[model samples]
Target: MKTIDCLGDMCPIPILKAQKALKLSPSGTTIKVVTDHSCTLESMLNHFKKYEITSTEVINGVWEIFITKS
Candidate 1:
């Protein structure tokens, strides 16, 4: 499990970082992204959905996304 803390990041920073991390991660790895921005969360979710990755977002502002290499 890899944890990504984007708590204070704004806009595309969190989403960009998460995408980079996912590219470097192996299959079946889990990445926990902590962000305070709802827009970033939504963008992240959308990206994940596009890739068919499994993700869960908590209204409290935490997004736990799971990715598996195909």
Candidate 2:
């Protein structure tokens, strides 16, 4: 499990960082991303969907995304 804090970062940075984490993660890795911006969350969610990554969005504005090696 790894945590990525993108609280102050704007769009793309959070997602890009998450992508990098995923690339380096082993199978069944869980990456928790914290972002204050809803748009960034939405973009990240949409981007994850394209790769079929499993994710859960909490009410507190936290996005928990799970990446598994294919």
Candidate 3:
């Protein structure tokens, strides 16, 4: 699992990074993204619906979004 810290990033930055990660990662690879923004999390959740992904709340306003490339 590769982790991308998007704690301070906003909007398209987080989603953009996730896209790059997915494009670079091999099949079945899971990339873990840490975000502190609700909008960022929501964007990722909806954007990642096309693939295998999961989300876990680590704490208040903090989440770990895992995306496994299909």
Ranking by lDDT: 3, 2, 1
lDDT of 2 at 39: 87
lDDT of 1 at 30: 65
Ranked by TM-score, the better of candidates 2 and 3 is 3
TM of each candidate vs. truth = 0.70, 0.73, 0.93
* Candidate 1: C-alpha RMSD after superposition: 2.6
Encode model 1's per-residue lDDT on 1-70: one tens digit a residue. Answer: 6778887889788878878887998866667777777787678767776454555666666666554444
For residue 65, what is the lDDT in candidate 1?
Answer: 55
Minimum summed lDDT over a 10-residue window in model 3 is located at 45-54
Which one wins by lDDT: 1 or 3? 3
Candidate 3, residue 17: how far the Cα is off, in Å? 0.5
- lDDT, candidate 1, residue 25? 83
- The count of residue-pair clashes in candidate 3 stands at 0
CA deviation > 4 Å runs, candidate 1: 51-70
Q: In terms of TM-score, how similar is model 1 to the real structure?
A: 0.70
Per residue, candidate 2 scores C-alpha lDDT tens digits across 1-70 of 6888887899889889988988998866677777778787678768886454566676677666554444
